[model samples]
Target: MIRSILLTAATGLLLSACAQPPLRGTGDLGVVIERASGSVQIIESDSHTALARLEGLGDLSHASVVYSRDQRYAYVFGRDGGLSKIDLLSQRIDRRVIQGGNSIGGAISQDGKLIAVSNYVPGGVKVFDARTLRQVADIPATPLADGSKRSRVVGLVDAPGQRFVFSLFDTGEIWSADFSQGASPKITRFNNIGQQPYDALITPDGRYYMAGLFGEDGMAQLDLWHPERGVKRVLGDYGRGQEKLPVYKMPHLEGWAVADNQAFVPAVGRHQVLVMDARTWRQTAAIAVAGQPVFVTSRPDGRQVWVNFAYPDNDRVQVIDTETHAVVADLRPGPAVLHMEFTARGDQLWLSLRDGDQVQVWDPYSLKPVSTLPAAAPSGIFFSSRAQKTGY
Candidate 1:
């Protein structure tokens, strides 16, 4: 009896300790997940170490991660259609939500109230309650050009009026859905925005949503409020065919960032990040990079841009000075720089190196690698603020 009582007391004490709020600023690093390795590492600002490494939730190499607005939780989605809720404070997976069907990508609302994931095979977007990570609604697949197959929601953006905008790679269209209610949500066909719309980012003010058109002239900009306003071509051709070519054979625009009244687009074929003014929608500058860059993200402070390339030999992360519009540094992290993300505070950068089977951390300002974290087939990563400790 005495031993059992003591053991119970010991366990209670440990649980109490785990329940306390984690060291602040540690969570400031936000969230990062490596798709191939099925590993997610969270680092706080400038911390020489990682706060927590949540592992084995699912196959991360093909998953997409997003942080809740409160920065407390991370929602992970696998390409096979598995969703897991991770507790940021405890550094453990809380539960798994089976989103029946294959997923291409997913996103969390800025308000942290909802999460929506694309089901490619079935052609639909599943919306869930941010708190419970429970399915609230399933928006059906929006139509596309005939014979194009239901375009997968490769990229999604939450907008006003409980509406979410998703991009389709197959048909080059953007669809809008409403998830105001917990069930029976409404979906609408917004417009055919561009060709091969892979990713999108909304302006800070929510005035416009810009979709990166891969293998096209440039970014296709749409009025978030009025999707029927047709579309405007923002950045110029990325030099796909000679100096300038017809729209059909344009090289392509893959990754993009909207900041400081300019949209920074990474033209993979051109090996350049074309900058365009948001208001005037004119070409401002073209920043050259090392290899076929895949992603262009803003520095934590939003003052600089970071470009990452793909495998089998993209061992470096390129840093571009947004102010000067110049390539500043190339950070050699390791093998295969597949996908990467930055913590909320922007103090640390997380990289998914496919060949290395590791997720690397870097100092955004100094361009120095801070640590190497374990991950499997590291792929998609996103930050979440609404995570919480769910008693398992």
Candidate 2:
């Protein structure tokens, strides 16, 4: 009887000595970029609370994030060419490296094993092992005709295969680095895609990769499934007759454009959002907005599309009914609305007000404020749901 009792007590003590099991999953967790401070506020979507603050991420003035396939980790790309791997459950930066001089954005491979960053100063795409932040391949941008220097890279995104596609801004060309084979990828070059391809995005299905043209009125689209068809220009004249304003890449391109059968794209320097037929790549309609639109994002449900403008009109937001192709709600939020993110299923719409120093959530249907979370010069709000998304 004494030995049995001792054994029971010893087992209980050993069990208590072990670490506790994880209490929360990472699915509802995310991070908000604190641009000025070079830190991020780890937030929870359900409770609408900030759980942790991770600092020393480097220059995040133009920072962007992508997620691992499981959504447990976030990869942040900063303007100072710093790439950080953050673990949500641990609330810490797992790995970090200064991979470039100036990085605009980054994307994770389809398999979630690689991370690619598009740089401006060094002017190329750097690929690293997602977990270790170790360089695997270095693909340089095409050199200018005069060979003065390499062109700047933009619109870096991962496709269906284990490939990284990006555009060269100075040279107006698109290159595909197929990494599926191994560290040395097969490179395919599409020269003269446009005058200057500013930014790009891949369709949800990963079939079409479209790069926005800042030097022209149209965009360049490549059918990834059939790259042999070459790059085709779509909506070539949609912005020709509008009051054009020079289109620039937002600090954080959080606005998602493709929704179901239609693509809601922001017209280059116009107070309008152009609706295009996703199948034929033709303009169906151009809905006039409050000002020159900066971020044109659609809810996950594909039922509503919300827009935030640039400069003086940046405070106002408008929602469009995709079915009716009409502006439904006009909301006046805080100043300098930098970016917008929808909850995994569109239950809530979150926005970062840089000038307001706040993060606001709203009901996508009623267009009313749900909750307000204070932030420090917040620029981007990303949710873990992005882990399961393509071209995030």
Candidate 3:
């Protein structure tokens, strides 16, 4: 009878142990790319703490990450053409595949069904199944008349209605591939868009697509709602008749900000952000900034615009007031401020200081440091909130 009682008590203890609740996870989470180590630090945005560090990613020197629709998986694109699907919940790379010799970046389809990667080595865009990472389509960049099939692809982005749009750096053309049907994608090519379309970006509403030209003075714009109008060149002759300074780094079009029917664009080889009226597509104002601006990103709430510089001025960041179009704050965050990411609600801004070897969180309103997380050569800070947006 005593033995039976002891067995019953042991079984009861085992049952109690099994009934213990699992650790709860915070929903506001992000990932910091450790470029040199080829790893990422999973951080909780609300608590501003590192939860886990994942490694084994290859050649992340120029890495970019996009999250799955559910924000449970991160699709990391490596410089060496490695695509890794990391399960953020488990902090492990669930699937990986070498897609090419060199890849620039990637995007996820609107419906969360496909993943597209832009390449440079072979010069084309490859689309894969988002769930399985299986190659579905190989849209090779159109060759020039001189029989060169090696036009480097850049500024690849996913548009609404299952379409992928990108530009050819060498060919000066933009192509949109519609994948609504199946693995075979229908292509729509726009020729002679401009000279050296360095990078491109689509508006948040997915209505307009713009490409920044490196070999010319202005940029090219296209209306996705009406592609029949062809590509229109705007911001005309912004660099005409001037002995321009040699560009140390190409300005990123992804940093362009759209708020209140106006767009803030970083001028190439100039220390200014061109404000254009979205309704008329004309330059409204030129907001002077410190040094050459590389990224002019807007706050999530569209209340302010944040500008970061290149090279000599990379250590400084400036915030611009959207209403007054003036520089409100000039902050020297740290050395080598490579990237900045805002929280989902825009309450906090996270910065990656590559030279400082740390990631700093700051209150966007006060522009004051909230916390610092130790890192190793951090460059890009990506938040899971980007999962719902296109062209993150």
- Every candidate's lDDT: 0.67, 0.87, 0.88
Model 3 CA lDDT for position 42: 87
Residue-level lDDT tens digits of model 2 in 1-392: 99999999999987876544356788998999999999999999898899999999999998989999888899999999999999888788999999989888989998999999999978899899888899999998888889888899999989988888899999999999999989888999999888888788888888888887766667798999999999999888643334356544331233547777898887756778888888999989889888878888888889899898888888899999999988999999889998899999889999999999999989888899989998999998999998888888
Q: For every candidate structure, what is the RMSD over all alpha carbons to the true structure, in angstroms?
A: 5.3, 2.9, 3.2
Best-fitting candidate, measured by lDDT?
3
lDDT, candidate 1, at 166: 73
- Per-candidate clashes, comma-separated: 26, 1, 0
The TM-score obtained by model 1 is: 0.79
Q: Write the per-residue lDDT of candidate 1 for residues 262-322, one digit (tens) a residue.
A: 7787664656677887688788887777766667887657688888765433787788877
Better of 1 and 2 by lDDT: 2
After superposition, the stretches of candidate 1 with alpha carbons farther than 4 Å from their true spots are: 1-26, 51-55, 143-149, 236-255, 311-313, 374-377, 380-392
lDDT string for model 3 (159-264, tens) is: 9888989999899999999998987988999999988887889988888888877777777888999999999998785432242666677777788889999988
Candidate 2 has a TM-score of: 0.93
For candidate 1, give the lDDT.
0.67
Model 2 Cα displacement at 217 (Å)? Answer: 1.8
As for TM-score, the candidate ahead, 1 or 3, is: 3
